[model samples]
Target: GKGGAEAGAIGNISIYDVDFVPLLDAAGQPVDPNPVGHGLTEIDHLTHNVFRGRMKEWSEFYERFFNFREVRYFDIEGKLTGLKSKAMTSPCGKIRIPINESS
Candidate 1:
């Protein structure tokens, strides 16, 4: 992004990929500091293991525990389709959450 003002005017901008590494503990093991932030591990891509439960209940959990506010949603309609969601910053402005409906 060479042009400061020009780049801002144009909506197209490349946001690079993210390789997340969970904070490790002293014992060289996955630290279970708490239920929310624990089981320290790192993966290439985003792999979400959503628990089995109701949709509204899960959404509420995100709101209550994580303080995530549902920003956008999409309804899937194909053979492998379901509900898609994007929850934006509620507690921290830097965080971005995207949760899909459980199959």
Candidate 2:
């Protein structure tokens, strides 16, 4: 039992038997899978809020520091709280962080 758990931990979660099956189109040509933006379609955004004018600076900061890009900017108009916002997402579309500011 010595070092068994440690050795198991190293390879436990790894998937090594990946089958490289080429996806074919209707005409039977292999499809190219390398797209420009790496993304996960179904993801969530962690909305971080700030004051109105600071939104741009904060968004740019995220883009420059982290590998995040601005996907959408929105002007939210709720009855009680109106806000100006922009949403930024990671390269894989996971871990989205939306920055909002009260308007």
Candidate 3:
């Protein structure tokens, strides 16, 4: 059972596939149907809050090597809260590179 769970964990850690879609003009209209040459349309910001130490290094690495940026940092007090992550963006709103450091 231990080996089986470890194998499953390893499998989950790997991302095998990704999907790309077209972006709209905010009026619910399809801007483009083609995806291959289009690349990512946006860069959404996501975060991982309430995490332990050395976790932020992973994000920092992406920022240094992968062009990601560390935009904002927040410290929640007196209660369990989420850290707000921030970054730059491209014209389209589909190519998000989230580098979150949990507090």
My TM-score estimates for the predictions, one after another, are 0.40, 0.52, 0.35
- Residue 25's lDDT within candidate 2 is 83
Candidate 1 residue pairs that clash: none
Candidate topping lDDT: 2
Predictions in order: lDDT: 0.54, 0.77, 0.49
Scanning candidate 3 in windows of ten residues, the lowest lDDT window is: 12-21
**Tens-digit lDDT track for model 1 on 1-103?**
4334343323555222112235577988775547775565643223233553455676677789978777666555578655544444456555555555544
Off by over 4 Å in 3: 1-43, 80-103
- Between candidates 1 and 3, name the one with more favorable TM-score: 1
**Candidate 3 local lDDT, 17-87, one digit each (tens):** 22234567889887766557688664455544324665466666666766655544445443674544444
In terms of TM-score, the best-performing candidate is: 2
Q: What's the TM for model 3?
A: 0.35
Report lDDT (Cα) of residue 34, candidate 3.
58
**Model 1 TM-score relative to the real fold:** 0.40
lDDT of candidate 2 over 9-90, digit per residue (tens): 2344423222345778899998778856765666466779797699989988988998799898889789998988788988
RMSD over all Cα atoms, model 1: 18.6
